[model samples]
Target: MKLTFPIVIAGLLAVFSSCAKIEHKKIDDPAYLRVFNNLNYTVSIENKDEEQPFLAMLIDPETDTSGMPVSAAIVGDFLDQRDGYAPPYPSHVGSSNSFKNPEYPGKESVLVGPVLNGFDLSSWAQIPSGKHRVMFMFRPVNNTPFFQLEERLKKKVLIDTVLQLDSHEVYTLHILQKNFRTKKNGMVLRQEVFHKMPLSDSMIYVNFYNMSADGFADADISLKKRIPQSGLLMFGVKDVMNVWFSLFTNDELRNPVPGYRFRYMTSLRQNNTSNVVQPYYSFPLFAANGTDGIRTTAWQRISLMVPGMNPENNPYNDQAPAEVLGNYAVISCYGNGTKPGFERDILTVPNMIVNIHSGTNNPQSFATVNTIEIVNGRAYLTTIQRKYPTPIY
Candidate 1:
């Protein structure tokens, strides 16, 4: 049967022996379907029809015990995981450089939940490898102290668009919200890893993910150096988008050279803010892995603490930097000049993978891919600048 937890999960006591050292690898098995959630709402998957159906029981309203919305049940599940040292726990653990999640005795554990952040990846939930139909359900509950506005709670379902799985490939079934306001939700897939690639080379590949609700359906990713200007990689909100590019940096230059740029625009400016004509947005990061193999400052791991990136309260204090670094870069589209992340937020946002060396745009925000890029050679990169009390020239 398909694995589905109830309001109170039975506990998958599969604790990691060492949280500090995680070497991600997929165990050899049949094709798997890991349900990846990137939404603020708690959810349940029903109407799970397939050649061999995966059965999961729902909280029957008639015999419900806790008397809470199914959505709330999921939220409750997330709350069960409390630790100052682990990932996915609440972002407030009175922390220092060590044990951000506040490692308590017997606190080294994780759980299954319907609601998840873009970075909160789950283990691959096994499924028969073939075409299948499944429906996602999310209930808008605004009572929590999270970022849900009065009108933020809107019910949604990501229709199955004929999901096909292969035994050799593990896929992330995720939901990327369009704008926080409109109901333009989409299901996008990211191949977490490819076993085909050699171990040494896989660590160097970089992939970019646009989770910002900026309303642009697509984005252009480019890496340029003075000698050979590499063409930009195209990414959209749909499909399984993964174009791997490795950054071969010299040992001296530990961090990837900064010449990375992510650009996109809002389809409708009014949706983002009540007052704003500038719908265009862009983010340019200064860190980089030098083009040649001789540069001293190579790309090393960096962390980013983004505010307002996740709707609830700001998450800089308690949450730890993402492990997806070296492979992922998350761009936050939600930010205002008056907001906390206005000035010093970028300092918290660094390029580890998703949140590493994060940069924001008054017009929009940008980050690196799953991997960082070192521009080949210094070339004149065109940019737009606004004149005081005048149009951007």
Candidate 2:
């Protein structure tokens, strides 16, 4: 019996060897840095997954849009005319700033600097009559080490190109609304950003559907920007109401109180240089299932952009002057705790349709109309404007 026990134990050990827990070693590297030039004209920074970190240096290229060179800061240091930041980094010079965001943990950091300074203006001196160039630098701070700091840092620099003035003064945007009706009688309205702007500097406008009539209220559209990538515009609407609004901006995320229940965002890509001519589309980049609070009912319809439309390859394809890309995005919430359906993928479409059912309390429906337009450093967001066709008794 003793001999048999020993054999049994040996066999068991061998069997579990592969199942043993594995631990990965931590990576160590001195604090590295990179720069993301919002060559697209908008300020945005992207990480490995292409996911945007909370750290962003929001700036409007139009603020210093000129063929002249100038000196500026990077993040921790300031520079007038140099290749890059000093020390550790070679061929770079500028000022740098660092900070963390309490809202997002461990991953909050930023480094901002000049892109094209007065020293770099030598190239633009005798060029075409209406040529302009603007540049910027970005360096991110992190808790852990990232890969390829040197290469990433250099690519982080952004450069933007613009014409002298009166570039593609297009001023037409589309507005659409989405309404949801759930079993609990829940209602929600969504706004979308449709059409593209050729100019890096422009304003956006959004109007409430029921402000003038009864049951009308207002919400402010929050403007947030991701340097170099893109920006987002969002607003919320509840119950049944009609509201009217008119707003404008030369800076996207800089707009103040554009509309009631609407928030606006812009991408750094707006300031990038590209040979392609088309407006980019705006669709929900992120959405929640609503399992925690204000659960939305199944079969509810919400505003969403229709998919398959190439926001970067469509509008201004054949136009003379370069073109700007534009698109729309919508978000909605429901209550009374209802089962979520396939709405999780609604943001992927260029146009979104969501339906909500709460069961037996209050059945509600809502919708939104959105548009995008650009003129030099000015942008506008305006909806088609709507009033309830019938009473909501």
TM-score of each: 0.33, 0.21
Candidate 2 shows a clash count of 150
Q: Write the per-residue lDDT of candidate 1 for residues 1-393, one digit (tens) a residue.
A: 676675225443333333345443433444533333333222224212211111111111121254322332111111111111122222333333432111111122222112222222223344445654444434332233221323333223233245666754545444444453353555555444433333331122232333434433222122111111111111112212222111212332123334422211122111211111121222223234332321122222222212113222224324332221112222221111111222221211122222212123122212222322111111011111111121232
Cα deviation of 77 in candidate 1 (Å)? 8.1
> Candidate 1: what lDDT?
0.27
lDDT of 2 by residue, 283-344 (tens): 22112233223222221122312233343333433432211122232222222122124223
Weakest 10 consecutive residues, lDDT, candidate 2?
118-127
Overall lDDT per candidate, in order of appearance: 0.27, 0.23
Q: What is the C-alpha RMSD of each candidate to the true structure, in Å?
A: 19.8, 23.2
Summed over model 1, clashes come to 56
